[model samples]
Target: MRADIDGLPVRELTGLEYASIVEGVSVDGEQSPIMHACGHDVHISALLGATRLLAEHRERWSGTFLALFQPAEERAGGARKMVDDGLDVRIPAPDVAFSQHVMATPAGNVHACLGPSFSTADSIKVTVFGRGGHGSMPHTTVDPAVLASMIVLRLQTVVSRETRPGEFAVVTVGKMTVGSKVNIISDRAELQLNVRTSTSTPGPAC
Candidate 1:
C-alpha cells in the first residue's frame, strides 16, 4: 500500500488560525502559497492507522504487507524515486498494491473501488489583452471585462457540451481579476484555470 504525503500549491483561505503557516510554492520562477487542498493529509493518516492496526494484530494473518508513504506526488514521479532508492530490495515486492483518496463532496464520505478515480491535473495562467481608455467613452476602447466574461462562460461548455457523455473531465476558472476603478476601463484581465480530464476538448476562440 502507498499513500501520498504531498499537497497542492494553493492559498489557504479557510479563515482558520491553524491554516498553512508556511509560504507558497516556487515553480518556473513563479511563486504561490500552498495548502493541503488535495486531501493528502487524510491519506497519510489512514496509512498510519492501517500500519498500527496490522502491527498490533500480527498473529491474525500469515501474508506479507508493505506500506509506502511517499512524497512529491504533486510533481513528476514520487514512485519512481522510491523504486530508484531501493524500495524493491528494502521491502518485499508484493503482487498488488492499493491506495485511497478523499474528495470534496456534499456528503463528505469516503469511497473505494477498482479502476481510475483521480484525473490528470493541468493548469494554465492566461492574461487577456484589450485596449484601455476612459469609462465614459464607449467607442474609444475595447472593454476587456465584457470579453473576459464571455471567455469564462464559454470555457464551461468545453466539458459539458463538447466532451462525450460519460467521459470524466472538469475545467475550472478559479481566479480572475480585471479593472482598477469604476471610471477606468482596464486593458487586460488575468485568469487561472485548472483542468482534470481523460480527454481533450475544443477551446473558445477569441
Candidate 2:
C-alpha cells in the first residue's frame, strides 16, 4: 500500500506545535534558504488546533469531519489511488478536496488554486534485456548495459525533442541498474522514471 503522507519529511510529529513542549525538545532547526525548511510546523499546528476546536465544539457543525493526513505526494498518484482503495467508501468523499503545500510558493502569504489545482504525475519503468557474456568477449553476446545507457541518454531527448517547450511536463530517469559483476556484462538493465504534468495528459504509468 502507498504511504499515507507523501513529500512530508520523516519527522511527522515535528510539524506539531505542542510537540516540542510535550517532548521537551526544540522544534526549530538551523535555517537554510534552499533547504527542506518552512512554516509547515506552524501550519500543521493550526490544523491540529482546528481539529481540537472541532472536537470540542462538536455541536457547532452537524457534519462529520475526516481529517486525512496523506502521504506520497512526491511519488504522485497517491491521492487518486487512495480514492480508488475505497477511501471515499470507507470514509466520505466530498465534492471537492483541498490541500496546502509549503515551500512551493512564497512565504508570508497563503496560496490557493481555483480551477486546475496542481499537476498530475505518473511513474514508469523501462527494462532492456540482453545476453550476458564475459568482459573479454565482444561479439559473443548483446550488451544491455550499453543499450540501457544509450536508452538513458535517448530518454533525455523525450522531453527536449518529443515534448514541446513549456508543455508543463517532465520525464526523469531516476534509477538504472545493470550488471552485478565487473567482468561479466548483465543480461538485463532497468530504468525507473517519474513523469509529471499539469493536466489530464497521460503517458506510460508504472
Candidate 3:
C-alpha cells in the first residue's frame, strides 16, 4: 500500500470548522498557511491504520506488506525521485501494489474499479518574452502580459473545441506571472500550465 504525504500550498478559509491552525514557510521562504487541501492527511491516516491492522493479523496474509509513504506528490516527481534514489534496490519489490485516494463521496462508502481511475498529468512552464517600458508608452513596448493572456484564452479551446466529445481532457493555466508593478511592463511573462488526459496515448487535442 502507498500513501502520498504532501500538502498543497493552499490557504484555508477563515472560520472553517476543521481548518488547520498551523502555518509554515515554503521552500521559497514565503511564510503562508498550509493545509491538506487534497486530503492526503486522510490517506496517511488510512495507510497507518491498515499497516497496524495488517501487522496485528499477520497470519491472514501470505506475502510481504510494505507501506510506502511518499512525499512531493503534488509536484508529481516523488515516485520518480524515490526510484532514482535506489528504491528498488533498497526494498523488496511486490507482486502487486495497491493505493487509495479520498474522493468527494459519502463518508462511509467505498468505491473500487478495475480499470484506470486517474488521469495522466503533465506540468508545463511557458515563458513569453517582451520589451519592458513604461505603462504609458504602450507603443514602445511589446507587452507579454497581453501575449500571455491571449495564450491563456486560446488554450481553453484545446479542451473545448479541439478535443472530441466524450474524450476526457483538461487544460488549466494555473499560474501566470507578469509584471511586478502597475506602472511598468515586465520583460517577460511566465505561465504554468497543467494538462490532464485519461489515456497515455498522444492525442490531437491534448
**List of clashing residue pairs for candidate 2:** 4-70, 4-71, 5-70, 5-71, 5-72, 6-71, 6-72, 6-73
State the lDDT of candidate 3 residue by residue for 62-178, as single tens digits: 877778899889888899999999999988867676656787788899988897788888999999999999999989999999999999999989988977787789999999999
Measured with C-alpha atoms, the lDDT of residue 81 in candidate 3 is 96
Better model by TM-score: candidate 1 vs candidate 3: 3
TM-score of 2: 0.63
lDDT of 2 by residue, 94-131 (tens): 77765554546665787775776556768888899999
Q: Which regions in candidate 3 have their CA more than 4 angstroms from the true location?
A: 14-18, 113-115, 200-206
Q: How many clashing pairs does model 2 include?
A: 8
Cα lDDT tens digits, model 1, 121-167, are 88788898999999999589998888889999999998779777777
Misplaced by over 4 Å in model 1 are: 1-37, 47-97, 103-110, 200-206
In order, the Cα lDDT scores of the candidates are 0.80, 0.66, 0.87
State the lDDT at 15 in candidate 1: 85
Which 10 successive residues of model 2 have the least lDDT summed? 27-36
Winning model by TM-score? 3
Model 2 ranges off by over 4 Å: 1-3, 6-50, 56-62, 71-86, 106-108, 112-117, 199-206
Please estimate how well model 3 matches the true structure, expressed as its whole-model Cα lDDT: 0.87
Error of 2 at 76 (Å): 6.9
